[model samples]
Target chain A: AQSVTQPDIHITVSEGASLELRCNYSYGATPYLFWYVQSPGQGLQLLLKYFSGDTLVQGIKGFEAEFKRSQSSFNLRKPSVHWSDAAEYFCAVGAESGAGSYQLTFGKGTKLSVIP
Target chain B: EPEVTQTPSHQVTQMGQEVILRCVPISNHLYFYWYRQILGQKVEFLVSFYNNEISEKSEIFDDQFSVERPDGSNFTLKIRSTKLEDSAMYFCASSEGINSPLHFGNGTRLTVT
Candidate 1:
């Protein structure tokens, strides 16, 4: 079974500081990786995804994630953090069975807080 | 851009009662999914529907849960007898393909009291 672990439960960063949210997964093979953001009272929004090729993936809202195959990790990063970027971030791993069945396993999520 | 929509932003049902959550996926989407998140917990995949039938489902989707595409535009999840554990925010999502990004609705907050 595939599982995701986000080490940090909550992170606080000052405005304009760089940010990185760590994510690690345990799976036998390389799997589809994704990062999603959820604002209060809103649905999950796709930040970025890593299906294949290009280890460094860019997404909306100036977010980027790098897929490290050897480490079984995909970490999301931003050069500068804004106050509006405060929200809970989730990292998910997509697994596929031999029969074309697929499922996404999500991590506990990291709550990002930006200080002005 | 089109988006997935779910009916009844919030629903409160008594334990042992039945509840139906409705969703309308994007018109051109080929895959539909239902996921639920308990308060402060990670979202869990309940089931996926494609071609008018269930393509995949997780263990959480027990015999008590059923899904149907009754009409052209409606996809529904029926819980035969709601339990307190069934209380969660149920999200409806749709994707064009296995690799495409899924668009999620605001979700129906099911509160079983």
Candidate 2:
């Protein structure tokens, strides 16, 4: 079984400040990691994903995350955050169920607050 | 860009009543899925469907819950007896092929009282 842990439950940052949301996972093999964001009343939107290749993956809305195998962590980071970036973020680990299909196990989520 | 769509953005039903959530996946996608999130909790996967059959399902998907692709494009999840605990936001998603990123719908808020 695979699981994800997001250490921060809530974080607040001022506009123009750098931000990082921590995520840790426990998986038996190589993991497929993803970051998703959900604004109020909105569905989960894919921020970025790491399947294979470069350790750092860039995503929509100027968001990026790095996959660190040694740390068992895939943390999302932004050089600067805007007021509109306030949202709930989730970290998930995907496990292939075979035949090319997979299911994602998500963390409880970290709610981000951006102050202007 | 194409998107998966779900209907009845909000639904209010009495406990013990039946409810069916509908979704229309992207035109060319081959895999479909249903996920739900209770208030202030992690999003949980319910089931995944492909080729008109259920490819996988989580333990939360039990006898009371069922999914069907009645026609070509519509995927529906039916709850035999709604419970208060079943009240949550349900999201539908679809993907093009093996390991493709999933595109999600806006989600339907199911409120059982």
The best candidate by lDDT is 2
> Per-residue lDDT for B28 in model 1?
85
Q: What's the TM-score of candidate 2 when only chain A is evaluated? A: 0.99
Candidate 1 chain B: worst-modelled 10 consecutive residues by lDDT: B94-103
DockQ per candidate: 0.59, 0.70
The docking quality of candidate 1, as DockQ, is 0.59
Task: Identify the candidate with maximal TM-score.
Answer: 2
For every model in order, the fraction of real contacts preserved is 0.51, 0.49
Inter-residue clash pairs, candidate 2: none
lDDT tens digits, residues B1-113, model 1?
A: 78899988999999999999999999988778899999989999999888888888999999999999998888899998899999999999888777777788989999999
Model 2 Cα lDDT, one tens digit per residue, B53-74? 8889999999999999999989
Task: State TM-scores per candidate.
Answer: 0.96, 0.98
Interface RMSD of 2: 1.1
lDDT of 1 by residue, A1-116 (tens): 99999999999999999999999999888788999999999988889999999999999999999999989999999999999999999999988732344678899999999999
Query: Which window of 10 residues has the lowest lDDT sum in candidate 2 chain B?
Result: B95-104
